[model samples]
Target: MEKMKLKLLYADLQSDIRVIEKELETALDSSSHYLKDASLHLLKAGGKRIRPVFVLLGAKFGQYNIDDMKNVAVPLELIHMASLVHDDVIDDAELRRGRPTVKSQWNNRVAMYAGDFIFARALEYMTNIQNEKAHQILSKTMVEIVQGEIIQIEDKMHLNQSIRDYFRRIKRKTALLISSSCQLGAVAAGADDSVAHHLKKFGYYVGMSFQIIDDVLDLTATDKQLGKPAGSDLLQGNITLPVLLAKNDSAIRPYIEKALSGDMKEDERQVFLKKMRSSNAINEAYHISNLYLQKALKEIEELPANSVKKSLKDIALYMGKRKF
Candidate 1:
């Protein structure tokens, strides 16, 4: 339902979305049967295509051309898709969107190769733009994304890290790519730098709020809503905002500590999740997500006031209020 709200909010771009969607279908023309299958499996598993939507929205600030914007929008989404395949391997995740992840459907090696192929295809599409800044920003973002994942592995099961640590991680791991999506779209369409800058900041704030809400929903939403077990992040030892806030309670720290120590059994997972959900930690995390949304709204206000701006504002609000 929350996702549907976004689709309705941005319905004006349905035409642009159709073009990007078709581009995604043909983005990877791979020879390897397994590679094609794995890529198709992930692609067929529907997503909101929020990154491409932002790309289209950003392009609205300038000479809107679906043809040119598809270059940026498609490649941005491909880069994101490639990251997800690799992420399932890192987290040993089995499901995404209620379907088996590429790593689970095939194998780690195949998933890796598929990810590489998708990334290379993204670069191939990106090179057509001939914008050095876009290329530089995306390449740097790609490097930072891997670095963020590396740090996630380094900090896994170590619950003592600060909130700033988590912020830095998400900025690289998630926000940067979305930020680039907006900037690349605007720049590609010949929007002025000032407008591009505002949209980039807008994407960053929206991305931050979105990820925080994602972390909160992991603890609060049901398996049916999440399409995976609730509290999967904690189970996988990913220390998210809810876990961090819950740790402030002396009583809850030991459970998290035990979970991090590998003493948490499969059956114990539900008990810990229940406690965290019943606590004030959820509220605290929500407050933070709302804070990010407020910042995102300010960024949107700076953008040219129009239907596109309204849609971007709607997206930020959805992040705060989404059930999953």
Candidate 2:
């Protein structure tokens, strides 16, 4: 399976990842059982943990110490976790990774408080690093992420947005955090500035490709694979790469309009889904994702060839080609 392949690619870091996992568990501990449980809910559901993997791998280019690297890794993952909790509330999402979201399990107010708590924990852990550059980079990334989400909210259901708009939104929504994971990890480990720059570029490209594929999967993958309904992005009025591309066709545009207008019937939704699957839009999105993948590989090529480089390369390839 695709997940198995991704796990195999990073198998060498299993022990370090375990340490990060434990640290995450410890970080979620709180006096309020409600906040603790809400915070722990999504963490328990699990994720690819790609952010921490990038952080750890980036550290490999410098002084690879698990203790030092974990400081960066754990907080990056926590930031991502906190974002997801907030995102679910924003999206009014019922499920994440096939399980009930915190907002759904508890309430929106609880989810918001839990998100704040986790973000506080992330900031607490980030203070362990003395690297001012790392802090600056992460702080900027966090701000951009919030701005991205704000833009997404504003752009919601607006079919007139350009591809440039989509790209700008995704860069902040997803890419920056992953990019920082790579850059900060290297900086934390005392890697050269040049090395960190290259790693950061690599993560940026991979993150872009990863998100494009995720958008494609939201349209093409089965509900079981996606852990939610197919076309959820479209249903929620978030125009993704495929929808933007597909909407250029007059036939598809009207359906998307109806969906966005909040009057689409279930059958019309299926019709749109069917047309999108067979359309060139999906292929076009994949082409863009592949381009980003190639750029990521180029960034990897700039790094010194080593097992870690190979691992990063493998992960990039997986991101471009992942089925779910």
Candidate 3:
């Protein structure tokens, strides 16, 4: 099913996501016309807004107020979008979400300035709440997230790294932001400490599973589905879970190793994709993701049995089962 149709299952949070979308547009606007246009270029390129959805759902467990929560919710998404613009520059990425990436559409210098501008705008928006705890959590998450990307660059082409290394990288790169989203939402709504804690844990588990599935789809899904080439990670020399698992195979390891050892032509890239898909690697990776999904569902079960919680549970389940 389409991501939107799937999200409609969580009807309770629909109004909140809509609020966040509008808030995001307002948040990205700037006094400087250049900054406003640049930020809006990335802003108008929509995403699933899953982070804000988690933020809103977590708020439901407390004295939920959309006005109170939008301050946190809008900034969180802008921070994420800012990172994406910078990441495309770092990766030399040409496209994002099936459209020309900011770095590709403009020069790297413009992209960098745009990202910095948006990040500052996000912090400016966030400052309205005056919550030191929220700032600490989000600031630290942003730092660690950047550190994770640096380490990912370090780990590239080193095929023999342990599974623990991959786990460590993804936890910082992907899971922490989602975790913070839930915590910030709870904090904004003045949810009890225990409820905030549980929601944070739930976001972490779901984020991990969600990212693992994304990595898997990088090797398995079509360019149309993924908005990029299949095996793009492999071609980029970023060893993901499926590649790491496939490397453990005596028969399959050498092909992937050989593929990684040098520059990949289009024909070679296609062969690498085929082998990775046919290997037990993808299956094993799915198994690992399912474990995290189960843990995520367990966290959801601990929340009050409200319809919002139930819908969050369904989204977690859907992450494990998504094919594209």
Which candidate tops TM-score?
Answer: 2
Candidate 2's TM-score: 0.98
Q: Any runs in candidate 3 off by more than 4 Å, and if so which?
A: 31-34
Q: How would you encode candidate 3's per-residue C-alpha lDDT over 1-324 as one tens digit per residue?
A: 467666776776777788788888887777877677777777677777878887788888877888877878888888889999899998899998798888887789988998998898789888887778888988999999999999999999898898999999999889999999988888877888887898899889988998999999999998898888888787677889998888877766766766676665777777777877888889999999999999988888787666687878887887678888
Q: State residue 295's C-alpha deviation in candidate 2, in Å.
A: 0.4
Candidate ordering by lDDT (highest first):
2, 1, 3
TM-score of each: 0.96, 0.98, 0.95
Model 2 poorest ten-residue lDDT run: 35-44
Runs in model 2 deviating more than 4 A are none
TM-score for predicted model 1 compared with the true structure: 0.96
Residue 91 CA displacement from its true place in model 1, Å: 1.5
Q: Which 10-residue window of candidate 1 scores lowest in summed lDDT? A: 261-270
Residues 174-264 of candidate 1 have per-residue lDDT tens digits of: 8888888888888888898999999999889888888998899988888998889887787688999889888878777877887877788
Q: Give the TM-score of candidate 3.
A: 0.95
| Whole-model lDDT, model 3 | 0.84
lDDT (0 to 1) per candidate: 0.86, 0.92, 0.84
Model 2 steric clash pairs: none
Q: Candidate 2 residues 2-112, lDDT tens each?
A: 767788999999999999999999999999989878767766788889999999999999999999888899999999999999999988999998999999998999999
Residue 301 error, candidate 2, Å? 0.6
